[model samples]
Target: MVGNMSKKFNSFKEFYPYYLSEHQNLNCRRLHFAGSCLVITLIFVAILKSSYMLLWLLPVIGYGFAWVGHFFFEKNRPATFTYPLYSLIGDWVMFKDIIQGKLDI
Candidate 1:
């Protein structure tokens, strides 16, 4: 598993390849896509209604689906634990890539 490599990346450019590698599973990617979509929707709803509670639920909605994908489908540890900021960026980049047909869902 890539997680076992224990490599440290100097930049997001370097980390993204490893991030993509860890999420090779189709179902895992799909779950991430769904979660990201929900996150965007929830954020919009929170803004529209001025709901701080819904804003707070963002991470839960995002990570819950992502963790399920990683654990059940990908069968690998999520990069989030070790690389929180990068992992969050990776998730959205991946979501865009999938939507734009750069990555398969």
Candidate 2:
């Protein structure tokens, strides 16, 4: 694991580049995008159906897909283990970037 050697970024602006580097693999990015889309749809379903239980699946669905991509496609440990908050933020940012054609899908 590269955990101990990881540099502490003072801001998300600095962290984002590193995050992007971790997710450079095309399949990994696609999985993340798919997971994020599922998360959004699930959130709306939970709200519309008033089924709070469905909300619980958010992390499972999101992380499951992402972890698979990291393990199989990226072949690297997920940054989420070391930087949960920043990683979550990166996921959304990357999702938007993909949508805006800034990042390849």
Candidate 3:
């Protein structure tokens, strides 16, 4: 687990560029984006449906796609281990970037 201090983003200004770098490969970013989307949607669904049981699978969904990207395309370990919450935040931000067409990859 990431300590709160360790996960503290000194600045999104710094973090975003690093996020972009880590997601350099188009496929990696796409996969990560998909994972983030699935996780978020499932979370909301779990909340709305009052079904907490599936919540346990959220991490698997999130990590599964992103890990595939990291291992297969990026060839790097995910920063999630070092910065779990921040990485989660970064995931959403990157997802937004993808949806907005701000990120080509």
Candidate 4:
């Protein structure tokens, strides 16, 4: 649920808790992590192969997987719709947390 629908966060620290709440579903978190890994791989491939065209798929891959997670798994609206910047930051932070074992799979 988007409980913070009317709440405005002035800092990422404040937004992160809400972000985590939205991603409580295991499948949603996994999809997000997988999407992030793919995004990273795609970036490296684009740079190493000099294929700037591949860079164009970044948003499609990143947001596509995330949207699927939110819609199908989380059964909630993505924070991206309302808080684009913080939500993007939250994605990376969540990825890092997952990798570091701060969050359960």
lDDT of each: 0.91, 0.92, 0.81, 0.94
Q: Candidate 1 residues 7-83, lDDT tens each?
A: 88899999999999999999999999999999999989988998868888888989999999999999999999999
Return whichever of 3 and 4 wins on lDDT: 4
lDDT for each residue of candidate 2 in 1-105, tens digit (9 for 90 to 100): 233327898899989999998988899999999999999999999999999899989999999999999999988899998889999999999999999999997
Worst ten in a row by lDDT for model 1: 1-10
The TM-score values for the models, in the order shown, are: 0.94, 0.95, 0.80, 0.96
lDDT of 1: 0.91
lDDT of 2 at 64: 97
**Residue 90 CA displacement from its true place in model 4, Å:** 0.2
Clashing pairs in 2: none
Which portions of model 1 show Cα errors greater than 4 Å?
none
What's the true lDDT of residue 81 in model 4?
91
Worst ten-residue run, lDDT, model 4? 1-10
The TM-score leader among the candidates is: 4
User: Could you list the CA RMSD of all candidates, in the order they appear?
Assistant: 1.3, 1.5, 4.7, 1.0
Clashes of each: 0, 0, 0, 0
In the predicted model 4, the residue pairs found to clash are none
Better of 1 and 2 by TM-score: 2
lDDT of candidate 3 over 3-105, digit per residue (tens): 2233456876767676677778899988998888898899999999999998999989999999899889888778787777767788888888888988886
* Error of model 1, residue 73, in angstroms: 0.5
Q: What is the lDDT for 28 in model 3? A: 90
Q: Who wins the lDDT comparison?
A: 4
